[model samples]
Structures are given as structure tokens and as C-alpha cells.
Target: MAKFISFAISILFFVSTASAAPKSDLWERWDLSNEASDVQVSHAQWSIFLSKYAAYVDPATNTRLVDYSAVSHKDHRVLKAYISMLTDIDPLSLNKAEQFAYWVNLYNAATVDLILDNYPVKSITKLGGFFSFGPWNEEIVEVSGEAITLNDIEHRILRPIWKDKRIHYAVNCASIGCPNLYVEAFQSSKLESQLESATRTFINSDKAVQFINGKLILSEIYNWYAVDFGDEKSLIQHLLNYYEGPLYQQLQSYSGEIEYQYDWKLNEKK
Candidate 1:
């Protein structure tokens, strides 16, 4: 009887531990392992909803409260879903290391989406006004069982663990000046690819920068995060690697822009 009782207790312990263990990730929704080519995903969903951005936006209010009942990127419904998924789910519910990665990436991605929800504005900073204002400070963007602020996710988690500089590109601030808004959601598996692509895409655009007198005029981003790109004297060298063209030599010779002109206007969906 004693032996039987001991065996039963052991079995119960094993079962409990198994049940409590984090879930195995059977699926990675997004994959961009192939670094040879730039990855592109569908924007049809976002485009469809954004087509009506002009109709729903209220200029006087300078507020963007569109129909996000659905999970449409353009409609901004995905923002709410992302927040819901992040806040309600348990962290330990996922496997240990994966849990942290998932948390940080989700925090970064969802924050961008939520900020964009109050979209149709000229600038993300506008959301915050002087002397005390702005929704960004609201804090506690609930997501995946986590109640965290943008500062928490950015400074605390992402900065500490991930040393990669491309994170700057992945986390959009939602102004015309910010990196181009990605349509689909960001998953861990696709993190590297998304970051690379965002960096290349943004730096290549005319809004943030322009090619002047054969010189590579860069956005303030390069200036602000010059050290982040790579340890090089010239900030322009970092961008040239991604930009492969006849102008490569030209960029090296001339990476300095006379000045930068970032569009404070909201990336309106007109």
C-alpha cells in the first residue's frame, strides 16, 4: 500500500508539471529566413480599409477613430486585437525564452498599432501637447497579460535583450516622418526580415531623405542613431550597404545632406 501511494504521488507530480509547462510553439506564422530577397506581404486588407480613410477621418477633431471592429490594418482594428491578445494571455503560458521574445516584439508592434489608431493626424508627437498632453503618456497599453507602457517595453525589455539596431525601423512612431507603416503583423520568426526591410525601405524613401547634388542626404534618424547602424565615421556608409546601385560609390563620396526635412503631417490615408 505504501509503495502504491508513493507511485501515485509521483504520477500526480509529473502530470501537474506537464500541465503547467509552457506551451510548445507548433507554428511560426511568419517566416523570412531567406535573406537573399526582400520579403513582401499582402497589403490588400489594409489598403481596402484605408481607401475609406478620407471618409472616416475628422480633420477638425484631428482624431482618428475609425471602424476597427474588424481586424483590418487599414481600419486599425488589429490594434485592439493586438492589445487584447497581449493583455489577456499569461506570459508563462508560452515557453520561457520564447515568452520574453514574444512579449518584447508584441509590445513594440502593438504600441505602433495603438498609436496609429488615433491616426489621421499630422504627427505622432502631436498626440502629445505641450504643458501636459498626448495619448502616448496614457501608459498601460494592455496586451498579452502585460500592463506596460511604451517606455517599459522600449527601454526595459527591447534595449536590454536585443542588441540589434534595426529595431528602430521595426517600431514605427506613425508620423509621415516615421518609418513606413507595415500592413501585416510582426511575428518573432519574421523579426529579422521585417527589421531589415523596414530599415532599407525607410532610408530609401524621399520623405525622410533625398539625394541632393549626388550626396546622400539622410533623415535625422541617421543622425540620432548613427552609432546604432555600425561603427563607422561616416553615417552614410551604413545605408550604402542596403542600397546597391551605380550610386553606391557616389553615396560613399557624398553621404551628407545639406539638411533634412521630415514631414510632420500624418501619413494620411487619402
Candidate 2:
């Protein structure tokens, strides 16, 4: 009886440990070594697809609304082919900037493919597993022999490896709360300016910052990932860097708590 009880305890311990372990730590393990600078990455296909399907609601806001309903059979095929091509390319063989731009485009294209696969749905969270909020956990793509998910692309690959807060603007969540999905594909040649533009556009947008009831309101992104932007003071300084006009001047003298909110509605065209 004593031996049997010991065996049961060992089994219980194993079960608990296994349950606590995350299935993947791809982000923690990613490291890019300097490689050949001339490796070819064709963003033309992705650019063409985006121009045809994505539309800006208002140029002033830079808000993009995807026309998921208008995706033709050919366009869907093209995007799938592009994603497949990405999986075959080794990031280790490309320069760091190229790899960075590659992952961003691949992630965005894959997300659009997933949403197009289940179009007409009210929200991306509605698709895939009935018990989950969205397909963030599902291993939906393969990259250089490793299976990856949307969560892996964002949290693991981009956020952890790049360690850039501006990355938040680059990876779209297919929801209104997310930064506007850029209609142009990211390219290594233009990465710096692209990242800067994305960050500035999002920081200045009403979706990210708003003044309400004599208080400051910010996107839940700033609240949820506060650590990424450092402390509250750091966040305000970061915003000031991009903001100009009256908003910048107003923040210069304001010291108060930031209220946070997010909209999860699918950013689809009407």
C-alpha cells in the first residue's frame, strides 16, 4: 500500500507539471545571425493583393477596413501561395532587416487568409474552436519545419525578438482595437520609415488616444502591455515624441491616470 501511494503521488505531480508547461516557447528561442544581404523576398504579390482588397476608410485617420467579402477566388489562391512561399524561406539566411519585414508581412497575410477562409463572420474570434475566443492558439502555419500560430508570430517571433514597441502597430489583430493594417507590404528597403509611420499614425489616432471628461483615455494596448512601453511616465513621453499640434501641448502639463478601452469588432468594410 505504501508503494502504491507513492506511485500515485508521482503521477499527480507529473500531471500538474505537464499542464503548467506551455506547448511552445518559439519566441524565447529565436535569434537571427547576420547573413547574406541579397536574399530575394518578393513583396509584389502581397502588395497586389492588399491594394485590391484593403481600403482606407479615411486617409486622415489612416484607418484600413478590409473587404473580406470581396476577396475573389484567384486572390485567395494567390495569398495562400505567398504564405506557402514564405514557409520555405529560411530566416537564418536573410539579413536581419529582411527577416523582420518578412515575418511581419507573412503574419499579416496569413491572418488575412484565415479570416478570408471564414468570411461573413461577425468576428475572427467566432471562427475555429468553439471553446476559444479566436484562432490565436491554433498552429496555422509552418515556417522552416516549425509549426507556428498567430500568437507565436506576434508574442514570440516579433515582440520578443525585435523588442520594439512599434511592432504593435505592424501586426494587425483584424480588429478595430488593433492598429490599422497597412495596405502596403513591409519591405526591408523601407522598414525604418514604415515602422515610424505606423507608430506615429496609431499614436495620434483617436483609437489610441482620446481626451474624455477632463481625463486622458488610451487604448487597452497601452494598459495590457504597459511593460513594453516602460512606466506611465515613459508611455507619456513616448506619445509626446509622435504627437504634435494641440494634443502634444496639452500633454505637456497633464499628470493623471490613463483610462483604457478597446473595441473588438471586426474591422470589415460595410
- How many residue pairs clash in each candidate at the backbone level? 11, 0
TM-score of each: 0.60, 0.87
Q: Against the true structure, whose TM-score is highest?
A: 2
lDDT of 1 by residue, 123-169 (tens): 55556434222334446565443456555555455544454666566
Q: How far is candidate 2 from the true structure (C-alpha RMSD, Å)?
A: 6.4
Q: Which candidate is the best by lDDT?
A: 2
Cα RMSD (angstroms) for every candidate in the order listed: 16.8, 6.4
Please give, for residues 1-270, the per-residue lDDT of candidate 2 as tens digits: 999999889878755543231332346445774565687699899999888878556554447889888889988998999999998888778887888888899889988899898887787777667445677778998877889887788777777677888988898878887898986999999998999999988888888887887688888888777868889889898999998646776676678877988887788886
TM-score of 1: 0.60
